[model samples]
Target: MKTYHIRFYENRWIYYCISLAVVLVGLICNVIFGTRLDIQFTGGAVLSYSYSGEIETQKVERAVESSLGRDASVSVNKNVRSAESGQVSNNVTISLAGTNSITPADQTAVLKALNKAYPNEKFESLKMDSVNPSMGQSFFLKCIVAVLIAFLLLNLYIAARFRKIGGMAAGFFAIFALLHDVAMVYFTFIIFRMPLDDNFIAVVLTILGYSLNDTIVIYDRIRENRRLMGPKTPYRVLVNTSINQTFTRSINTAICTFLAIATVFVVGSVYQLNSVV
Candidate 1:
């Protein structure tokens, strides 16, 4: 195997510049678009309707908007079932979001609009549900508390495990990197207007866990190299060497993860699975 030396410390400024640029762009996007909270976070209503025929998502969106006199987030799902006679039937479900409880009158108005749009298709109201804002607020607070506790525990674990080689600094930097990742995810949500729901919490937690694992591996290597190289070894040399030794492992891991995610994304797109995509 061919071995090549990499001077990460010498080129640290370049990495810093790239990271800073990305963070700045994300912040700008957040400022421009603002945060979008979903019904799960801000308390709202979800109206689900099932239809027996093909329906254009755009038309359904228009119908809901006209009836409610406001724009809403809309999603459609299709299900296929076979009867005992071997005949196949398609069921389309349309979900609409609202900021308040959907009253009987409101449901009637929406149904009237949908009926007008699709006179031949039979529409059945599957369910209409509303979430209280207070409950959403409580859930949001619990999520925040959970994340904070996780971070604290991770920092303490890292500090105790790697105390020989600037453990405090290592833990702080690892936490900082995780926070940056979380901020980037939040920025993406703002830019895309993705609802801040339980899914958002899951994504943040997953990213934090993945990043912390990688950071701990690198820190472990640095601590081991420091012990082998003795106190005479320069800090810069130790860090760069440790990073270079693990660089291949990190790259391979990232590539494999990317491929897995890409496959799922492609399948979701092909099948028109909005939630998966």
Candidate 2:
């Protein structure tokens, strides 16, 4: 069998340089655009309404801002209806993000303001959802705690299960790789000016598991190779050999994952949130 042999450690600096460039660019974007926390994390209200005909989102934003005396984001979409139904409705979703909740009086005022601005549009409230500031803070902290617990538990497991083949070192590098994945995800969100919300927490935790699973597969291969090649083998050679053995499997796994993600993105784009009401 023709086996591949590549010295990953020898080219470590190239990877390090690439990672540093990513961080530098993220920092520059942060200075220019800044980061935003979603209402799910920051605490506030999301008031979604169905409006008649065409109306500018900017008008809705201005009306809400005037009513509440705080900045609000308004998203307007037309032709939103379920795939099963022929009926469609134009909607305006207003997001009030802050450390304070929107009060009932304020909600009433915003509705009045919108109706007054566009009497022809006939605005009607579909739903109102609010998150307490303290509750949001608590939830955010819980997500952090969950991630920390996952890391700690995974490390202990790896160290116990792979002790014959530098388990502690394997676990450390695995965690380090997971952190790199997390940082990249965070920076991607910040650079795109996306809100760090529940979706952010969900994605991070999901990536943690996925990345750890991939790491464990290579570590398993390494443990098997170490036993076959005997303990006297050089560590670099052992790792490179095991990695070469697992390279094809890893590439296949990544390709499948990418295709799954692409499928979801394409479906979402095609539907244009018609199911969202």
Each candidate structure's TM-score, on Cα atoms with residue i matched to residue i, is: 0.81, 0.78
Maximum-TM-score candidate: 1
Clashing pairs in 1: none
Clashes of 2: 0
Residue-by-residue lDDT tens digits, candidate 2, 66-142: 98899788887777774656678888889999867767788789989999999999888888887666766788899
lDDT of each structure?
Answer: 0.77, 0.83
Error of 1 at 235 (Å): 3.5
Q: What is the lDDT of residue 84 in candidate 1?
A: 54
Candidate 2, pairs of clashing residues: none
Model 1, residue 129: C-alpha shift (Å): 1.7
lDDT for residue 182 in candidate 1, whole number 0-100: 91
